[model samples]
Target: MLKKIGIKDPEKQMLKLMESGAVPYRGVKQKDVRNALEERFEPQVLKSMTDEASLAKRYPGVPHEEAAYREMRRLTDELNSSDKGNLVEDWYERMYAQRRAGSSNRPESRQHQKVSAAEWNKNRPASEQIKKDRFIDRVDSVNIGGKEKPALHEIKSTKGKLQERDKEQFEDMMKVAKAERNGVEARGADGRMQKVDQVVYTLTDPRGVAKNEDWIVDQLTKYRNNLSFEVFDAQGKRMMIDARSLKRSKDGELVLPDGIRNRLGLK
Candidate 1:
């Protein structure tokens, strides 16, 4: 689920973004953060982790031991937070990340006792965990009012399925953003540089991505015409400036967002 959200360090990155003024949707307070997060995640985005740490009561798609493990961990965190709803919410993410980390810390090369296929099937359900590598982040720059204005954009992927057309349309928006950035960069030294706006496209899905070829091609073509792109540093941060307020970076790149630069600390 976290894998499908397409963030290498979602908790950390999101924390940084929040500090940078990317407020939570619907104005979540510290108290509301837990319910907000449960509504936002847990079901789809945190499925993999939640399933891996279950309770003794047994949950569908999750077994007794793991569910029990999760329940125990939950109690531990509650104790640590003194049962404060907000603090518990914060600790919940950390605990979840820690559990995920612990589960993945093992060396995969180690081999255990072999078992018959039939026996393994009957007992191995509790051990199998989903392993996936998928990314869905997008960016764009566009022109507005035909005045060569720039609008930089970012797109987030959801865990659900999407129609190819919608995906392509999103890509088109990014292309426009990139093109708008280019036009502004090419603008003469009139000191009256075209304005640029930053836009965003966030898509959330639960069943994972569904590829759409025609939609992909259409988006690719449209973005090709725009020829717009946002390079990243190591941290998945944007590494370009908006058309209106671009300041050339020492590394021959434009000013980028802090969240992006942090993601790519190399730059």
Candidate 2:
């Protein structure tokens, strides 16, 4: 059916797209998929394929192709509608819901094994830790701090003011960090239990504004200061800064202060 419409080897094209990580899945943006498709096929060709009459005529005898075209049309229609960004978010939410439901249906022993694996993975070295890219609140990267303490970094990019959701997410990360600091000891790569003297919650906002920085600093100083978990730990002291003061490396990675960087051995 695709060949009939001058779309040669649709399966091969799709496979290539998937191999290039252009599919609309977790962490893959809708714009990324659109850009990839636009690069692969002519814009007019895509528009023609999405046209109702064209699809109906081209896919008349192929039920599978017809169903696929129907889905494509539905997605195209949704993209053209008012709720553009919400469609991808809603789809991901549904996927997460289904995953949770499936996990809940697992036998008790299987669930226990999963939990055990998670626990085991938690204490693994930073390089050995499993990546949780699918999670919205997952740690962006991990760094070794002074005395070899593991520090988790949460990176965010915004062109304007920081959102309340961002604060909430960072707070959640701090809570988890605090819990881990007080809980069981973490082992280093050498298999020795390492001490966690402090938990650092570093926010790397490359485009952060002054107002947002002041707001977050005030929130930390006035309310979260007593939380014991350091919002920005520099050496053994707690530190706060205007987001604009944050520096970046030549390669665009966030650059910590000389003291912290030297201690952490971060390049």
Candidate 3:
């Protein structure tokens, strides 16, 4: 019957048909089995199944068909929902602007910071100076001296409250910032060595809950002194006043304060 219907391999078609009907314990319906077989026998789908089977033979431990279906579904969903445009726009608006607007002297609104291995530690003993280079955390922004002192800005956006790892990361960053303030030079994107005068860490919560912000501020305060915090709504509206300035709104949803707004040039 399969050969009459133009199925190229009647024996394999019979195997599939028998497998589809083997689940009688679950009260399988004849129509369901027929639908399944009809889909499996479609020319393109059947060819894909054959290709997957061939690959399974070539590579032992690979599942026959279910794995292919799962991978195909995952790729399809990812392609459908990817935000490549938004990501590009964000990189341009945030990172590119910072890199191009070198130093705070440029009229651009943002600044950039890069940290690399300190220029080949010559003063240290030969054994200490030739240590293997390791990667440290990267700061989102670093503004070196204009109206305000040079500072490192680490921005984190979280849906919920900050985690333990976040606190530990802040501590490690503080060490780097302190070293920079103490005449330690860090290589920037332009390849010039620069030192930071201060450290400013910023945390942004997208959920914008008053309680969440309060808890985060408390946790950070106990962990370290002199950290900045910002909260924004789901729509990206500023929700909390600058914590550094020690101001709080009645409803916990306030625009950026005058000092910070003027410094950041935000409306």
Name the top TM-score candidate.
Answer: 3
Check candidate 2 and list the clashing pairs: none
Deviating ranges (above 4 Å) for candidate 1: 1-151, 163-210, 227-267
Error of 2 at 154 (Å): 0.8
TM-score for predicted model 3 compared with the true structure: 0.38
What are the models' TM-scores?
A: 0.23, 0.32, 0.38
User: Relative to the true structure, how large is the alpha-carbon lDDT of every model?
Assistant: 0.34, 0.38, 0.41
Sorted by lDDT, highest first, which candidate order results? Answer: 3, 2, 1
Clashing pairs in 3: none
Task: Estimate, for each residue in 55-143, the C-alpha lDDT of model 1 and write its tens digit.
Answer: 22244555443443344333332232223323323333343324433342221111111222333233323223112211212122233
Q: Rank the candidates by TM-score, best first.
A: 3, 2, 1
- TM-score of predicted model 1? 0.23
Show the lowest summed lDDT stretch of 10 residues, model 2. 106-115
lDDT of 2 by residue, 3-107 (tens): 444677887887787777765445778777655654555444444534456655655654433333343334443243323223322332232223433442221
Q: Over 4 Å off in model 2, which ranges?
A: 1-145, 180-186, 193-206, 219-267
Q: Estimate candidate 2's alpha-carbon lDDT, on a 0 to 1 scale.
A: 0.38
